[model samples]
Target chain A: MYNKQYLNFLSGLILLFLSHSLMANVITIEITGTPFNPIKIAVVPFQWQGQNLPPAEIASIITSDLYRSGRFNPIKETELTSKPVKGSEIVFADWEKLDVDYVVVGQLNQRNSKYEIRFELFDVFRGEQLSGYNIPSRTKQLRNNAHVISDIIYEKITGQKGDFATQVAYVTAIKKQKQLQYSLHIADSDGYNAQQIVISDEPLLSPAWSPDASKIAYVSYEDHRPLVYIQETATGKKKKVISFFKGINGAPAWSPDGKKLALTLSQGDNPDIYIIDLANNSRTRLTKSFAIDTEPAWSPDGRFIIFTSDRGGKPQLYRVPSIGGRIQRLTFDGEYNARASYSPNGQNIVMVRGEGGKFQIAVLDLGTGFLRILTPGNLDESPSFSPNGNMIIYATENQGKGILAAVSLDGSVHQRLKLQQGSVREPVWAPYGRSR
Target chain B: MNQIKLLSTGLCVLVLSGCGLFGEKVEETDITEETTQTQQQTTPSQETTQPTGQQVQPQTNNVTTNNNGNTGQQSNNAVTQGLGNRPNTQLNEIKEPITPPTERTIYFDFDKSLVRSDMQNILAKHALYLSENPRATIVLEGHADERGTREYNLALGERRARAVKQVLILQGAYADQIEMVSYGEEKPVSLSHDDESWALNRRVEFVYQGQ
Candidate 1:
């Protein structure tokens, strides 16, 4: 009797899987790594008990998020023998037979006007619930809530925090009537619901997120000059922070403490890195070199500032004390390297590495002093690490138009985030939550 | 001396006619005629008075004399000199056309900001023009090919512009008359991704104000 029932359940799962695959026009991730095998897991579709359908699909978001990390291979929903919406309903034997190591089940309940999501993650081998969460969110915030659940499940299993709930800020360039229109945009890590934070006809470059993720600092070329501005991400209000300089005032990088910005200022000579205190507006020169020194990125600990300098005759990564002291060269592999950003843990640095005639994204391990090339594009640049340090997003050209692309740090997973009618660039991943 | 004069006048006519093909639209015919006439009068004295090795000295003197005679017409001659050829003979004579400047772009090597040896004479011409015209101003717009980081490219562009500015300053161009702005790789004269297009894009352009 149980064998006949299992056959019937398998057929039903096959039908549901075909239906879901046909209906969902999801942004699929293209993973490319042969040496590493991803963990197998199953994310069951959440039960919808609310009066109206949810704004975002919770299970699919978690599935894509986990799959994009290149660490988890989410099982097809149709492969499940039974649809479990809670921990009590989960059948470990069925999941074990399907070869999935873990399973995620959830239920979305509406309490008056608010929505609550209760999710349970189970270890199919152990046949026990590993973790659970009841997250309350608004209808519009359901996508973020789903990401939060993915984060919880990911951390519980992998022992590393997931950056699914974080945001990515990038610049988009649209050619309109013989002129390029540039805009700064902030979107979810999965590249959904992108909102323009600032727009101008002039070119916008080098966007840096503050520690709290409440503000973004970028370089804007308005009034025929490059000026740095700090704008609140939520309100869209901005203030010109460094416009009075005669020469270049650009590459604003927020310090870890959010008290200052390390920037590049030429002042009619060779450009050098400088740190500007946001409180009193006092500027301190960092590197005194005749070679070009720019693109300053602060360490996560705020103890050192890594910047791009061509003092060795080619653009390479260098580090200096935050308060200004001896400068040390960091990168020695490639002929050209620049725009280095520290990983969240500060163990590795992601940067644009140019070799032969092509530029691609690469990472430098600080401890091992080895460089790993992560991209295979001719013109890839502006690499920013996800807050969890799992993925690196950067700008690359496709058919002569700029588009954003993300790759797993190990180069196992790759995904492209493209706009419908314009080019995107300079993607900077926002920091984790404010509480961190 | 007469043969040299006749040869120089003939050469001047050939150069001016060539300039008429690419000279500024407003000064096309006038520049050709005025430059031919000035060369007829100035060439004989310049060629006869100067030693063979000092050809550039007489040419520079003749350009200044023509400027004193008719500034507008002589400026047109300077423009013709800039547009005619590579100035293999008289570098200073080709350099004096400040008001109606013709040679604007200065090209550079890949990832380099130093003023090329070939561009030095052209830059000197612009410098002499700016020095002669005190009220005149020009913006040195620097650019780079689509390679490397944008911010560093901006600085590289500035470095190229500053290199030109240094040459101009050394050649007596006023500090206030020259303003430098690095467009980096934002503006490209050629959009293709090749060596020729990149070479065209990696340049500093002299944009004269109130021209």
Candidate 2:
């Protein structure tokens, strides 16, 4: 029934990748570090059935999403042998001849004032439809629907949950009229559809998303002092949770349950980790050391909290029970290690490892304690693992400008999300936890 | 005979404390201005006779924690006991003219928080002014360069601020007279990313609130 409705509105499909050049202000992605062999796939452009152009290019978005993941090599449009709108029409022998292991085809139909996107994924060798979906969409949500389909196709093939539909919140700073304008921007993981959720003249740091992805917990120095606040993503409503301690009040991280925020606060002497209960704003001190202890991150199970501390003569990663218990040092291989957060599986941790003054992102395996350096850096920091634990997004200096970048867990693929203007830093990848 | 005896006593003091500059001799209690870090070399115990609260060691230790009077001394007990917001009492009076130090920003080496020897005299001058005026208050705004992670730099900034606060208190400034805040790498006076700018950014500024 849906295909018959689509056949009437069907407009001839145009070549992929060349139909539309995005708006001027969009972030440009520069990908590097492709492994020797990645799974090759082709995403055929979806045929649209409407008087005008379809609201989005579903197949193009999915193709790029997979390409950016560093696990797949998407076939370019110029090399494609066909643009089939249905999985049944794709010639398996032709795709196999092109060395395309997997092929995706889809169609869009506008009916009764709403659009429906239907797509199918096929394995060329098996010559069968692996996954198919018919998703209803609104006009403005076309981009999101595309990402949703990307996530679906991604998980079906890779056996890992797709975080492509997740959002990334980061702090952007630009000097306007000699005054620094700092804005907190939340954008799609692909650096598309970015919206500024909060703006202030003072610097903003450490944007953490609530487990449910409804609110953003961040540190802002708007009143000339750092304070922790959780702002709703939908509405701009904000609630200040942390008190104005005499010293440092910063680095807010939410617990897995979203009921508490693991914060680094310096009341007077030095910075230490404290968990602030959201219900009553009651805080529980987790670590007590005269040395600096900040950047607290909770395990996936919320059983223990790991933080960066200099208690052992030099800075390193340390962990303590969530409710407070014996503290154990986690990293021993580096002279300086700080700003650590656990992976989704809670097996490996990523951190900014400093050697002398040069800092780089590194992942430490909990079982092996083996530290693997991920990026070449004079300064690469603020790493957050994708919900699937496959990629790490962080902020680094690109051409002397602060920008956001991502790397696969094994350091196979690298992508820099370069902004058109201004400098961006302190990007935190939000957890989708979506079963979709 | 008294003159010769004083001269011999001064020489004996100098011999006992090698190269002791008069004010530096007050290592135990860094009394105020009258004792010009003149190295105790300036004059023999001239300012010692003057009585003050924190200085003039023979006086009362009761005012030791005048900062204890308010600002929730409970906060001093636990790191988060003062979670409930409490406003700090601001001393509004302009401070006495002891000629504050020209060098206001004390710069630190990368990630190092120790107060350098050269900055001691400058810290002493500010401490002297604060000690003389009981109502005077200053905010030590700590900062770090954009080199490391923001949270770690936040801790580093606080470390620098605390180190300066300790030194000032040792130099006779009241704890209540100094309020410390670390901005970390957030507010940089120099936007440029380089060695010189980072050096300028990693500093603690003495913002005299009552000035």
Tell me the number of clashing residue pairs for each predicted model: 1, 8
Q: Model 2 over residues A5-94: C-alpha lDDT tens digits? A: 676545323332224435523688888877546889999889998756576778888877887788888888899888998877888999
lDDT of 2 at A83: 91
Task: Note the DockQ of each predicted structure.
Answer: 0.47, 0.48
Across residues B84-123, which tens digit of lDDT does each residue of candidate 1 receive? Answer: 2212222222233435468999999988999999988899
List, residue by residue over B160-201, the lDDT tens digit for candidate 2. Answer: 988999999998999998988888898889987789999999
User: In model 2, where do residues sit more than 4 Å from their true spots?
Assistant: A1-24, A48-55, A108-114, A433-436, B1-99
User: What lDDT tens digits, residue by residue, belong to model 1 across residues A74-153?
Assistant: 98877878998988888788888889999999888888888888899999999999999898878668888888888998
**Residue A363's C-alpha lDDT in candidate 1?**
88
Instruction: Give residue A31's lDDT in candidate 1 (0 to 100).
Output: 42
Tell me the lDDT of model 1 at A303: 95
Best of the candidates, DockQ: 2
Q: For every candidate, what share of the true interface contacts is present?
A: 0.61, 0.83
Candidate 1, which segments miss by more than 4 Å at Cα? A1-37, A48-54, A108-116, A134-137, B1-99, B117-124, B190-192
Clashing residue pairs found in predicted model 2: A9-A49, B21-B39, B21-B40, B22-B39, B22-B40, B22-B41, B23-B39, B23-B40
Q: Candidate 1 docking: what grade?
A: acceptable
